[model samples]
Target: MVSDVLLGELAALAVLSPAAAFAALGAYLLLLRTPSERVVSRAVLSALSVSLAASLAIWGSAVAAPYAFVPVKLGHWFATRSYAFELVLLVDRLSATMMVLVSLIALTVGRFSVAYLHREPGFARFFLLLALFSTGMLALVSAGTVDLLFAGWELVGATSVLLVAFFHEREAPPRAAVRVYITYRLCDVGLLGGAVLMHDLAHSSQWGEVFGGAPWPGAAASLGPGAATALALCLFLAAMGKSAQFPLGSWLPRAMEGPTPSSALFYGAISVHAGVYLMLRVAPLLQRSPAASAVIACVGAATAVYGTTVGRVQADVKSALAHATMTQVGLMFVEIGLGLYWLALVHLFAHACLRCLQMLRAPSALRDAQEIRAAHAGEPLPPLGLAARVLPAALVRRAYWLALDRFHLEALQERLVAAPLMRLGRVLDRLERRWVAALSGWPERAAVEPGEPDAHAPGAPERAMAFEPAASDRKGART
Candidate 1:
């Protein structure tokens, strides 16, 4: 019983340690001046260190009893007659493994950033976001209920967008951040919808309730084919956005605008694999629904192909590595769809380590290449695997053009989706202004439109007042 209590406390600490650090840092930034660089770095590292220790302890306990499942119930947030929201954390082999991975990687990144971002203006802000991200990721992996998972998922998404736009002064970073935000917002509908469906179908959103009390990979969800398919696809939609698969993946390479440590922590390692983790968590749903599995496999295969083809044509080292990461994540998704859950997990862990190292080294890649060329006496290197050598010239040229242009995915998305939505927003804004003018007894022509000069501006003609104070009141005020 004492051991159980200790394990539960450790699980809670694993999540709350980083959260407390984030709160402290955020408070300092808001109520007081930003802390010194050393202070910020040490605070973040200390938080992650504590989290890592707690996670390692949990992992040790899990190892002692292999495949151990421990659910720590904090309490119920609210309870309705038909529905109750509970806060629960699950520490099993899967979540414990993920917790250790997240904590270790975040700790390493935090330490690396102390030097990498030295003397930078936004150093404190970057560490603050990193701490918040650690908390979110820990919460995500340990969440035993869909509601808690969604909260963590949003935290991860929000922080990812902010980090991608870390250099907010730059034009490109903000634009890329917007693109990522849009993709996440659209895909998050799947997670929310899936949660609602789970509640309605299972009478609860708890994993134990939805998938039975058996352990993962063996637990079978008690749901029919149609219901399982709907839920699985919805959840997979959320995964697709987070994972940066295929058509939704253009925002990833652009996300390289952030600092290297953030790039490594988010895109290369933890954040990118979040979707696959979600899928693995619900493996039984896919097993129940063949249609869902087939769709997942097909999309994963297409994303792998797309990533490989485009990755080859990227001019920059970071973009190429981003696409390579995407290809590997795509294959992991395929593994999950094929019901190779353990293999997918192993692949995820190994790939995350490799990709994080590559992202951190990306800035030095060009210098390394130049040094190699210098050592070779400036001799022109042979094109060892040029497509031109084997393929027809015309076909090779066409393929190169397609790959270079990223198959026009961005252009097509703008034309079909973004452009129309923007026009509609503009129209809605004009209509809202007209309605406000009508209700306020102002002339329709006097209504302000977007991008137009305001009538209240200094140089513009003043509009007639809708009302005036009484003359007696005005005279009293003067007196």
Candidate 2:
């Protein structure tokens, strides 16, 4: 309809607002202009406000039309004989609602950061990452093509890692950042592979072609059960990492190394729900594959139990909340797996708002605990019922220890995944060195001093300094 054209322009405006903010802040930082905290905060909030307004308008239009699916064309980025890429944004109830939610939360978090991070050294940097995430999330929610979605997905992942390592001066933040990055890289292969398969099977990456374009929730998937199963499994792998399910769940608590505000926004609210959103968006394709749906349900149930158990044993408030988030998100995933689409969406939105508030008020946790204690006159509360009471004492102790160690999931990942890759890397490094030596027609140990020895030398450190002046002649050379 012609009215949908107006809605399309509005959708474009919504996506562009946060992008503009990112460009503005990026320009200021790159130019070495010391931005005032107030100025940066105002600029970001203003952009978010504009984006929020546009998203509301889009939602209004979608409601009026009821079942309309509008696509706003931003032109093709490239084309070839067999492949093409375009920037297209879809407007439906699902996407419009998501845009509204993302903008609203981003605005709230942006405002909170201004006061919370006042005069901190990396104040500007924090805002920059926030703006980047806002832009990416908005784009991802609205993307109508696999190519566009992948672009937005990568942007969000990059910002997540950077924010995790915001306190670069600290040792733990960088290590946590590395872990997050590695997990993302490994899990992202699913998304990358899914996109390729979409092109190969559908011959086009557009939502209309890929999912038969019936306007979400009602859309029929174009793929057969077999192809759909393969695609869905690939996407499930991506969702597992993003949602922190099972073996991939260890990184969620560790991500708390950044500032509290970031922990609130990224893990507590938006980033953690990205995987669930992905599942909801592709629900139609999932319907074509019973196997994929079963896997999703099983994983979600397992994650819920895992999160709840680990949360009980966490020593710190943030980590406890992180596990709690995982628990709730797992429930949402289960809802989606059971074909309860609207319920899952509502769960995602409500959980996000609630978790944001809890994370922001986390610092006051001690004060709140004291108030409760005083109210109760220092008496401990009665124990809540649990299965532990029925178990033997030794078995209870073992369960407690297992829960405390987060079931050793991180250790399992390192041994099964990281250790093997590291060993392979070292082997390849040796082979590469041999190849280079062969190509250059030089012996591998030629650089070592006669008495010093090579890399394989015994009883002494390998003095294999490359092209260094002889140690005996160093004094004369200096003279």
Candidate 3:
């Protein structure tokens, strides 16, 4: 049997390996010019290999002593009279499994990207973000407290956004990145709120304290129905966003703007499964809250229906795969809500592996289709999919239109949420401009004439009349 101290060391190594690589690569990029592609690939691959080894070792130890749950305390971040924020790491069946999966997938993607993105200008930047993502995911899986998990969660989100906008010169990637960032930010409030609620109700956000020390799926949370329900709902909201559940899922298809490797890593595999991992980690709490479970089930069912309907009508392979992934993820959520925690975990693993493979091969789909047709003696491929065979003609046509328009979810969101927010932002911008003018003794110029275009409005020309240069400034420019 592995000693507890050895297990602690191994778990810490699993998380720190990638973190150290991220720091070193970041420093090298900033201080020195971009290192050779070989160097970047080696650094990232080596880190992932180490992390994977550590995770496997931890897993072996847990298997030797079935139902093992180990909590390793690194140190305290701060100490107060009532609360001491200690950095803790956990090694358990679920976490060890997740750590191994994340490390393996990241390593595979990093290796594939070397050849796939060869000669690309942003090679170093891509590897750097990949390293950061690996570290964040490792930390998220192994974190012992909600506070630590939240930090890791935010790190993952930031890296995701950066990678989505990796092609900084492209207009669409940045816009898509912004959309994803907004969705993440808005939903992350649930995680923040849940953390606060846990601290208040349980007096500690530590998993051991909140869910008890027993191993997961068997451990029971010591909370009243009311408290458990509230906390469960909040965490589920966070899960809904990360997993791309209904109404909040539109941003996911757009996320395909990033590189194929990134799309596979983030959407097809580990990143998309993060929410299911969270639900599994908190299975005990969900068991205690029937109301919360019902809500989760309803949302999951809706998303599953939505994804399946829209996926079939997608004209592109990547978009189709994105929606297909959403469909599987939604079913996983349904499994969790139905209290089939083990089944949900199995589904997550299988779907992630399959989807990752599909996404990696997505770019070659057209070639594959050609090969298939040639094998069939160049006969036109017969119609595939159940929709054509099973659905009534009228129903299929109606569904097609709805799916093609994505059920107008985006349009509704634009009118109800995004438009209002933009108007508010414009109002705030005008107020700030007026305040600045008052401070700079240009108050008169701040007043806008009726029907005149706002100088800062989109596509409107900059009005020189807004701020005429002073005579002394003009003379200085001439000299």
Candidate 4:
């Protein structure tokens, strides 16, 4: 449904601003030589400002009076006789909330990035990726179809990967990023599979019928029961992986390798909470799946407790923040699990604001405040009074231990995912070199050099990339 007040004018402007900004961004990027990071970063903030204004105008128009939004049909794809895809934008209550959240986060983080990435080597790359990420998120949140959601999902994942590996010189960032994309691949697998399954359920995935009330003869009634439960389960697995819940949660702490602002943008908001937005997008299906919802709750609870305990122990500011994000995300999942979908949205909104502020300001403020207090007093305050100042001493003691050990998840991952995978990989490497090589006479080329130079090898044309496993390591992968 569309707005009812100056609906045409508001919708027209909202649609135009983002499209115009994107086109301008693409054109300038194509022609430009070496753009200044400051200039580009400012441009990001400017675009965000404009987008926010445009979204507010549009929201002002969402009157209860009957209305509908017809998104510009940019393009389409056909998978089969029954399965067709298209890039059609849709603006409804759901899409609008996302627009607001994404715009707000982009503006805040975009501004923060200016100072954080300033004079850094990858500064330009950082801005470009950030801009692209925001663009994709805006599109995804405002989209009308599953295909559009997938496009936006890919965009978010791409931006996150770039940011995660922002410090490519280090082993940790790159390794963490690799693990990050592995989960992304898992997400794509589910989304693609779900799309196929959905088609069989409803003859079409068009925006007009899927979410509209009067059911399409055969759509799965509720994601809560039976076959619906299966779809819900798949969706849950995908969301868990993307949101960094337990089994796939390790990538996040390692994800701290990016610049502080990138970490702030991702872990603090935007990409990290993307799964929540996605779940909301399918609230109807989700509301039905009690068993699946139970799973979500369990995972959220597990991740929350684990993340909190670990976050408290972390000695480094960034790592502590990362685990804290895990804890809050778990809490967010609690809202989702409780079927307080609206509250989940509210929690996501408020929590993002508070956490980002705390992360960006807390580290130095503690030392500064304590030093000032100590100097003014010229003597230490009583332990009891000091304990009452902020948190209880017991809690602080707990946090100290939790943050330091990372709640032992590090050890768990090494044993379960990484160590086992490495051992199997070595065995597979030997097998491939011996028996497999005997069958196929092609000589193995080293991975460091990708291939014999092809036409696009020198300056490759950018294309939509799926989540693929990392092959060669720039810093980590101690082979």
* Prediction-by-prediction clash tally: 0, 0, 0, 10
lDDT for model 4, please. Answer: 0.68
Q: lDDT per residue, candidate 1, 1-479, as tens digits?
A: 22767888999999999999999999989998978998999898999999999999998988787757778999998998877789999878889889999999999889888999999999999999999999999999999999999999999999999998898896777777877899999999999999999988988888887887666765557899999999999999999999999788888888888788999999999999999999999998988988999888889999999998899988888889999999999999999989899999999999988999998888899999899899889788777665779999899889889998889888888779888998999889888888888888886444687556567676555333433334421110000
Better of 3 and 4 by lDDT: 3
lDDT of 3 by residue, 1-479 (tens): 89999999999999999889989999988898889999999999999999999999998888788778899999998999989888999888889889888998999899899999999999998998898899899989999999889988998999999988888796778888888899999999999999999999999978987898888775557899999999998998888888899999999988898999999999999998888899889998988888888888889899999999999888888889999999999999899889999899888878888888999999899898788989999777788778878989999899899998889998788779988997998788778878888999978657553456666667556654464544421110000
What would the C-alpha RMSD of candidate 3 be, to one decimal place? 7.1
RMSD of 1: 8.7
Which pairs of residues have clashing backbones in candidate 1? none
lDDT of 1 at 277: 94
After the best TM-score superposition of candidate 3, give how far the Cα of residue 252 lies from its true spot, in angstroms: 0.9
Q: What's the CA error at residue 202 for candidate 1, in Å? A: 1.0
- When 1 and 4 are scored with lDDT, the better candidate is 1
Residue pairs with clashing backbones, model 3: none
Q: Candidate 2 regions off by >4 Å?
A: 390-392, 443-479
Q: After superposition, how far is residue 469 of candidate 4 from its true place, in Å?
A: 21
- lDDT preference between candidates 1 and 2, better one: 1
